[model samples]
Target chain A: MKEIVVISGKGGTGKTSVMGSFSYLGKSDLVIADCDVDAADLHMLLGPDYQRSEDYYSGELAILDQDKCINCGACLSVCQFDGIQSENGTFRIEAMNCEGCGYCQRVCPTNAIQMETQKVGEWYTSSSKVGSTMVHAKLGVGAENSGRLVAQVKNEARRHAKKEGKEIILIDGSPGIGCAVNSALSGADYVVFVTEPSVSGIHDLKRVTELVKGFSIRSGCIINKCDLNSQMLDELITFMADAGIEHIASIPYDETFTAAMLEGKTLVEYDKGPASQVLIKSWEKIKQFAETEGCLK
Target chain B: MKIAIASGKGGTGKTTLATSLSSHLSETQDVVLVDLDVEEPNSRLFIRGDQTHSQSICKQVPEWTGDCSLCGQCQEICNFNAVIKVGTQIMLFPELCHSCRACSELCPESALPLKPRKIGMLNQIQAGNLIFVESRLEIGEQQAVPLISQTKDYIDNHFDESYIIIYDSPPGTSCPVIEASKDADFVILVTEPTPFGLYDLKLAVEVMRKMKKDFGVVVNRDGLGNNDVLDYCDMETIPVLARISNDRRIAELYAAGELIFSTIPEFKEQLLLLERSLELSTVVDPV
Candidate 1:
């Protein structure tokens, strides 16, 4: 099975929106995964009928036993985060501040602190209205271990794809060059790097492309809002050419793309406008590119 | 006063609001802009200045000195999964390491030595009328929270109490956002008006409430999608600090890497209003 992850280093560059459209445009047997656990919103487009919800545990957190606590402040001294809070003469471990370093448990004098696996997030398997089984997750606000969560979401997507005999997994990836993005792009057959024509977008595109190249992944490019700056588009083309990355498609800036999202529908479903046609054409190019890598065969 | 501009999702115009307000406020008051969005810091794109200061951030990672047997005590004690021992080989993954110092302390042979590894860089960019503190993590580095924390520490170390500090944070309600927003007097969450906006904004709201930080929402791209964001803010009784209308002229300015206050003369009035509302207030229950 092959997985094509759609990611953008810059935020709001239409990674999720493109993935939403792909959910409708792609083959019927596609298992989709939303790997943006930190701010997952792909389900906003798909409106999945969640079938199962499970707690995700990664990393460990120290819980202080009030009974065993001698109020010695030993854990407080070792904590670099100041995660230990002294409240009304009793100490408590601030979960957000705790980095799960396990130093607090080790520093406890009376064994007052116990290490427990933290439920940092939740994952779900849902059937989307677009007829694809979706695997998505929500990382707890301010929670770490997002890389582990993204891995779980992808693993679940692959398992679902195997059970249903689906040959492809479409992942909606997160922004930035963080561990979560690494997790989404890890072991993927192809990566579709989406970006826009702007200074920040170009700046981030360079960094993310460098990241993808390090993984040795075959990647394609989709430039959204290419009409914003012809100069930037030209720059992007030259950069992609020099980097040996595939410049698959460039879609012009259109208000309908946002309008379609406002209506809770994909561009093609909302209106087969010029922009929608461009996206459809781009999807075709992506399929051909993936096929070239023996992904379809 | 320290005000942090944060968003639950990426590309929600945190830099737009922060830079606009910083530029406007610098007209009269002392101001410092801290770009804590280490991974993809773009605030530098909006502002121009000289490099006043620069520093490389280093973390302590346990490096084996190859002195003795690989008894695997270091690997067993590491919570970050940064150390792995295969056969006689002891490999240290610096990227995954959190530098908790437990592994090095627990090593039986005292073979593990704390080695300083460069993770990112910190800069004090001299923008017009203010100092802009920015952090840029090295590409392929996984841990941003440590780098973000050091950046915050740098701000505190040389804090000028007279200046109004504005922190422009990375998107997402993750560890990076938390590290940036941890000590802010007030957090101004910049969000767009859409389903995705509301969806992520709610997560951001949950994070702020958990931290008990003084926060209010500023609905950006007001007319782009729908009233879901505003309606949710009203329903939650959370203070709706400001609404930045989505005018094509503004979009053009932003696309061209220009600040709204500089190009659009009339928009300065609204930005000033946002600047005024940033004063610390008693927490209004958003119940």
Candidate 2:
């Protein structure tokens, strides 16, 4: 099966909007995966009713038992993260602060410290209204294992695709060049970069393009809000040319996107305005590229 | 005192606040701005500087010396897939190594040894009185937290009591963010007034609380949305240090690669007020 990941260097670049529209244009033979575990919003437009979910654990967290506690303060002194705090006469561990370094457990004189696996997030497999399986997740507040959760979400999506005999897996990747983004890009056949026409936006696009190039992956670019700055738009085109990236399509500034988002609908479902039409044309080009590149069987 | 400006959400005006505050504070104090947003750092755009020094940051990866005895213990302990055993020979992918030393530390035959590999670059630039430092992780490098840690080492080596350090951290409350904001005396979280902004600001606040650091909020583009951020501060008893209005001129200047505080003189006074308030709060609160 082919995997096409849509990613943006920075947030609020209409990545989810474009990915949502792509899901609409792509047939039922596609499986959708939302790899933005930290702040997932694609499910809002996909409207997935969760079928099953499993907790994701990454590492161990130390828990201190108050019953066997001795107020020696040795654990606090040796703790590198300052995770142990004295409250009211007992020592406690802040789950978010604990890095699970095991220094506290070792320094504990009473043997009251125990290491336990932490549930940092949950991965879900659901059925979307678009007749496709949606794989997504929610990283618990102050969670430390979003990268692992993203991997799990992608793995589950691939499993669903294999079982359902789907040909393509469209993934909505996260915003930054962090571990989660890496996980989303790894082993993907094609990558689509959704970016804006601003100074910082162009700068971040270059950075993410460099990251994509590192994996020796084929990538294309789509300029969202291409009308925001004509000069920057020209510059982006030049950059794409220099980087040997295929210029997919340029989407104009339109309020239909925001309106569709507020209504929790993709632009194709909400309105067939100029922006939506532009997205459809963009998808057509992407389809051709995927076919020519042997991404779709 | 060193303060790091950060937000869990991107496009929250972290670079604006950090550069503007440094410009205002540079009039009296020697200020240094360190851009820890290695992924997409933009502090150098606002403050122009000449390169003073540069160095490549490297991490130690394990190398198999073909000393026979291909025990499968290295594969079992490495959770990062950095080492994979292919028949009798073990293959190592250096880019995927987190430098946790689990493989080498647990090797029974001592077949694996640590070797240094460059993963990122660090540069120190001088913009008049402000010393700006930035790190760029090499492409395909999976370890950013270690680069951030090494960047902090640069700060530690060049730190002076005469200058106040300001760090512009990367977005999101992950390991890199934690490494940047680990030992700061104070943290300033920049946020907008939107619902998404408030949601991410709350997550950043939770991280700060967990780190046991004193922090406050700076609402950028305050009038763009409702006063929910103000209400949140009121409810949580956290202080709203400053509220910057939505100004098109400021945005235009930022787009033009101009410093907002230099263009808008009033923001300098607000930054001074913020500095004074932070000073007083730190003095009043016991360390």
Candidate 3:
């Protein structure tokens, strides 16, 4: 299956909106993966009915065995994270504050502090109204293993695509070029960069583009809300050309995008406006490029 | 006073406001600016100063020695699979290692040794009366939280009694942001008047509430959208510290690498008001 991952260097750049519109256009043949585990909002727009969920455990957190006799301060001194605390002559572990480093478990003289695998988050496989399998997750609050959760979500999407004989796997990647984004782009066939037309937008675009190129993944750019700054749009186009990146489409500023979001609909479903038309055309071009590159086997 | 300027969303004027406020405050009083956004630090662009000191921040990862007896205990104990043993040869991926030291401490054969790997750099610079300390993670490197923790250590060790330290934190309420905001006297949440902004601001507030840190909001691009942010803050009883209008000049100045308070004299007065307001509030222990 051909996989296209849409990512924005910065947040709130219409990455999800563009992905939602693309989902509407390619409703039948695609599997949607929301790799933005830090704040997964694709479910809100796609309105997926979650079917199956599995707990994702990657790191070990300190668990105190209160049955142990002596209350020693040995674990507290070695814990650099300040995860261990003493109160009322008893020792306790704050899971949220723990980095799961196991230093406390190591330093505990009595072996009372045992390392236990804790569920940091959960990944879900769901069915969206668009007839596409939606794979997403919710990172536990104060959780540290987002990269692992992202990988799980992508793997589930890949498995679903192979099982259902889906033609495409479209991923809504996380913002920023962190571990989560790296996991999303590891095996992707194509990457679409959705960026805004602002100074910081251009700045982050360059950063994330460098990251995307580091993986040797072919990428195209789509400047969302390009009318917000015409000068910036021209600069972005020039930059894309200089960087040997193709400009897929320019989506202008539209209130209908927000209106659609408020109504729990994609832009294509809410309004058949120019923005929706541009997104549809962009989706077609992406499909053509993927097929030309033999990504859609 | 130690104040942390943070935003729930990236590019929401955290660095911009922190640098502007630092430059303004430095004119009259001693101010130290700490850029704790180790993942993507850009504060050095705004504050050009000669480096006074630099240090390396490292985290401990397990290094397998040739003395391994192929017991497989390290592999079994590793929850992250950072340690893998195949055919009596043990391998470790440092990037995947959380540095929990579980493998090293649990290995009975003493095959795994805790090795410190430099993941980032901490730099201290002096710009007039203000001191700028910035933590920058190495390219393609993980572990921003450790660098932030070390930066906080540097701040504690080198903080001057007469200087006001303003911390410019990373976006999001993750480990790195929590590390930056820890032990701060006050936190200033910078946001814009948009749906996404509101969504993220609430998340940041939730984090602050969990941390029990006192905070207020500063709405950037105030007049661009309707007063939904103001209304939300009012309804929630969260104070709106300042509302900066949609100022093109300020934006241009920021893009041009010019300090806003220096270019726009009026912002200096506004920043002074913010300083005074923060000073009047009682300080609380961040812990």
Candidate 4:
């Protein structure tokens, strides 16, 4: 199966909106994976009828036994995160502050602290109105290990694809060149970058492009709000040409896209306006490229 | 007072507000506009300053020693999966490593030692009353919180208490945002009135509540989005700090890299009102 991830290094460049349109307009049977686990928004557009849910444990949590009291403060001294708190008489560990480093566990003389695998997030498999399977996740608010959650969602999507005989997977990835974005990049046959025409947008696109290059992944760039600043658009085009990256689409700044999002639907489903029409053409271009690419594993 | 400009959703004018606020506030107050969004720092482009100083930030990753025996103990102890036994050679993913030193500290055979790796750089630019401190993370680095932590720590250690820091945070409710806002005295969340903005704003509010951080909201591009953000803030009793009118001039000025207050004269009155609100709010948690 072929996997195409839609990502923008800068947030609110409309990655999810573009991904939603792609999912709606695509002809092949596929799955939608919302790898933007930090703030998964594609599910809001897809309205997936959740079929299965599973707990995800990316790291360990240290639990201390109160009965085995050794007030020696050995655990406190070795902890680098300053997670331990002294309340009245007993020492307690703040779960949020702890990175599960195991220093406190190793330093505990009386074996009071033991590490337990922590469930930091949850993933779901569901059926969406677009006639495709959807794999998504929710990382606990203020949670760590979002990278792991993203990986699990992708794996599950791949597994479900194999089971159901799907041909492609459309993933809505998160922002930043961080752990989560790296997880989204792994094992993807194609990556579609949706970027804006602002300075920060172009700068981030360059950074994320380098990251995609390091992974040796075939990629494409789609410029959203191309009319915002034509000079930036020209610079972006030159940069893409210099980097030898394919420029797939240039979407005009249209209110129809936002109106569609407000109504909780993809642009294609809401209205066939200029933005939606351009996206449809973009999908056709992506389909032609994805079919001819030799890098698909 | 450290005022953080953050929004759960991106492109909500965090950098725009931060840069303009810095330039305006510097007219009368001491301000250090620190761009804490390490992944993509952009305030440097909008503002002018002298390249005063820069320092490279480093993190230690585990390196296999020559006399290494693959006991797998380091792999067993590490929670972040930084260490793994790959045949006779233990492979390390430096980007995934948190540099907590647990794997090296717990290595019984002393074969796995800590090695320094450059992750990012901290930079300072002096623009008169406004000193811009920006952190730029290396392109391939996955972990941004450590660099963010160090950058904020540098601010805390070097800057005087009287300077008001306008910290611009990365978008989302994950570790980076948490790490950036940890030391903030007051947080000003900027949001539009769209559904996407409202949903993410609620999440940011929930996170701020959990962290026990005093925060208010600023509605940007007011007429473009619906009244949902304002309605949500009203229902939750969260104070609405400022509302920037939906004007093409704002977008045009932003595109041209012009300060919002300088180009649009009306923005100053609203900015002053915001300054007043911040002053009133900071009294309870005074410096």
| Superposition-based RMSD of candidate 1 using all C-alpha atoms, in angstroms | 3.5
| Winner of 2 and 4 under lDDT | 4
| Top candidate (DockQ) | 1
**How would you encode candidate 3's per-residue C-alpha lDDT over A88-115 as one tens digit per residue?**
9788887667877676776677888887
Across A1-297, the per-residue lDDT of candidate 1 in tens digits comes to: 888899999998888888889888874769999998999988877878889999998888888889999998888887877779998878999887888888888878799898999788999999998888999988988888799899999999999999999988999989999899988989988899889878888889999988888787888888988888777788888988887778888888777877888878887789888878878988888777776663211
Name the runs in model 3 displaced over 4 angstroms. Answer: A51-58, A66-69, A86-91, A129-131, A196-199, A225-243, A251-277, A294-297, B50-55, B223-228, B247-257, B262-273, B280-287
DockQ for each numbered candidate: 0.72, 0.26, 0.29, 0.66
Residue-by-residue lDDT tens digits, candidate 4, A1-297: 888889998887889889999988863488889999987888778889889998887677778898895777888777766678777768988877787888888879899998888777789999988888899988877888888789889999999899989988888899888889999999888889999887888888988888888888788889988888888889999998888778998988777777888899999999978888889899988877777666412
In candidate 2, residue B185 scores what lDDT? 90
Quote the lDDT for A190 in model 1. 88
Q: Write the per-residue lDDT of candidate 2 for residues A197-220, one digit (tens) a residue.
A: 777778888888888887767778
Pairs in steric clash, model 4: none
After superposition, which runs of candidate 2 have C-alpha atoms over 4 Å from their true positions? A24-29, A62-115, A129-131, A252-273, A294-297, B105-108, B225-230, B265-287
> lDDT tens string, model 3, B1-287?
78999887666788789998887778777789998877667677778779999989888998889786798988877766789998869989887777767788778988899999988889999998888999877656656777788788888888866678899997776667778897788899998876666777887888888888899998886666456778889998987887776677776666545678766766665665676667632334367
CAPRI class assigned to model 2: acceptable
In Å, residue A110's CA in model 2 sits off its true spot by 12
For model 1, name the residue pairs that clash: none
